[model samples]
Target: MALCLLSPGQGSQSPDMLARLAADPATAGTLATLAPLAGDEALRVAADPARCFANRHAQPLLCLYALAVGAALSAEGVEAALVAGYSVGELAAYGLAGALPAAAVLRAAAARAQAMDDCAPADSGMLAVRGVAIGEIEALAAAHGVDVAICNGDEHAVLAGPQCALDALATTLAAQRGAHVVSLPIGVPAHSRWLQPAVAPFAATLAALPWQRGALPVLAGVSAEPVRAPERAVETLSRQLAATIDWARVLDVAVEMGTTVFFEVGPGNALARMARERHPGLPARALADFASVAGAAAWLRRQLA
Candidate 1:
């Protein structure tokens, strides 16, 4: 049996997330180091639900949360056979795997958010569609001029574009039997072509950061491929900014690679839930489900055993 560590993206942060992590001794120091990197106003922003969901605040905070949990897990002597991050969480995965320093991941996340913000259209956003076929989703997105941002599976995908277009698409999809559509909290069109302008600048930011070989492999969100070298990491990381994320492929690759258990090292259990829904029978849990890191580690030990 093998363990795969997962880190969540935006839409996973909670108002009391910082407070919860602060109460954990194993993660406190890491949070302290990450809080400032997120911003001088990070703590305040985290406390306010309105501000925390903004791309500028959400990106760094999510990365910080993931890094803190990752550090806590490592302190407990838990090692991952693989690591995969969703959207912004990809940066934290690198930090957890030792490709970059924890501090550097926060910086990169901040820069990435800024880059995305620079190109984001005023009314752009994302919408999640479930219980629908990919072909229908693509056709609807094409008709509405939106783009498929992330493919979670054949029946689940995220679309991004103007708010009005997303609303139209959602209306159409919601009318269908067994279809569910929900607007995501993320304000920017993350993996859509609308984010193309953000790529070059973010690439420069990542290229400037110091990198080293990680202890474990990380699955690239843009593709289901393993990233072992710095150049590959840089390419996939920056390219994914405006490219479609094949998250379904990531999960399939993880299972094929012998991932018997999945652990989400962040505030919410969304990633874990997705893993369970997609692969049924695979054990998956999130850090937020446990009262302490040690408890999570113990659970992981049992699952792995």
Candidate 2:
């Protein structure tokens, strides 16, 4: 079976997200290398509910968590045929694909978070809206001065802008029958033109990194195209910082590429859930759902067998 690895973004983080990885001896070395790169307070922030979701802490920690899990799965001989990530998780996807070293991915994630924090306007954030038509969401976003950040599906999208504007849009959508809106914990209006200022600097940061074609192809979030070359990877990685992400297309293209199994390496299982929801007949599971890396690997092996 061809396997696709899914990496989740910020909203998937939880207080105890790293506990399992930290306790696994198989991943001890990876955590040792990445935790320091993430920050002196990385573990502390991860364990603190209030601070963990902050972009500065969340980005690197989530990338580090995904890399550590990917490493452990690799050690078990579980290989991915393709990989994709949502938002900040895309950095981890590069590392998982071997385009960048794991440590570099953590460092890049830190720099990315810092750049976004520096460029993003204060009090700006994201909101997930579902059960509403995409056109209606776009119209509401235009009316409320927000931008559509991500298109998760035909009816599910995420909007980003000043918190006040997001609140206004949320208020408008709340009145619609069968509509659902939730304010994300993210502090930056990621994947919107509001973050355009972050694009060049982060591009330079990615360009400076040592890169190589990896064992598998990574689907670009911005275009849903397979990225195999380093130059293209850098371009898409940076451009995605300020462009809308077509995650719905990414999922569609993964299926079209013959992905028979979807496994999420993550701090949470949101990506896996999305995959299963979008392709119910496909086998999909998240590392977070298993008690151990071995268990997850075994399940993946079973699917492939």
Candidate 3:
């Protein structure tokens, strides 16, 4: 039974995320490694709605969630034939794949957040637009001086630009057939051209780091294929910071690679939901879906059997 491991990016985090994980013995070791890296106010900020969305807090915390959950699953003897991630979650994916250590992954996530925050203009953000075709969304965003940052599927995309432009675009799309627009919690415009300045510095950071090709096949989010060599990790990680995300392709590639099941190893169920919707025949569940990592691990083992 081939399985795919998923790591979610930002916008999926909540206050109780860590607190819940802390209760699970299966995940304690993973959390212990992450707690110090997350800073003293990590748990407090997660519980504080106003502070959780701040890039500095959101990025590392989300990555920690992914790494911790993935670590727990590994500790329970579960393994994935393929691994993938969304945005900053990709850093955690590398850790899951054994390409980087958990500490290095968290540090890289912090740097990523800082770099993106520095380049992001004040009052700029991302918006989720459902029921609009990607092509149409791109056209509308271009007209509003924004960019289509994420293409989740044909009719779902995330647009990024200045707050004013996003508002204007949202208003225009609100009256369209089947259109539903919602402002995201993020303040920085991620995965858009606006973050291009962060690429070079992040590239240098990744390049300077030591890496190893792990046992599992890790898919590159941008290319939706195996990143076979450690040498390519730096370029792959850096370029995706400012490029558009093609998550639909990532799912398609997972199926092509013989993934019979999926485990979304992170805070929310968004990635699992999307996978099930796109490929109903395959079973997918988020780590949060179970009472504990032990429960999730046990269930997955049964499913494989």
Q: 147-204 in candidate 2: lDDT tens per residue?
A: 9999998889999999999998898898864679999999999999999999999999
lDDT by residue for model 1 over 1-305, one digit each (tens)?
Answer: 89999999988999999988888898888787779988898888998988989999899999989888888888887889999999999888999888999779989999999999999999999999998889889998999999999999989999999999999889889986467999999889999999999999999999998998745899999988989898888899999999999998999999999999999998899999999988999999999888988899999988877
Once fitted onto the true fold, the runs of candidate 1 whose alpha carbons sit more than 4 angstroms away are none
TM-scores, all candidates, are 0.97, 0.97, 0.96
Better of 1 and 3 by TM-score: 1
Specify the poorest-scoring 10-residue window by lDDT in model 3. 208-217
| lDDT (Cα atoms) of all candidates against the true structure | 0.91, 0.91, 0.86
Poorest 10 consecutive residues of model 2 by lDDT? Answer: 25-34
Candidate 3: tens digits of C-alpha lDDT, residues 1-305: 98899998888998888888787898777787687887777777777888887899998898888888888888888988889898888888898888888788878888888889889889999999988788888888898999888788988988888999999899999876568999999999888899999999888878776687645777787788788577677888888888888888999999999999998998899999999988999999998798888889998998777
Cα misplacement distance, residue 44 of candidate 3 (Å): 3.0
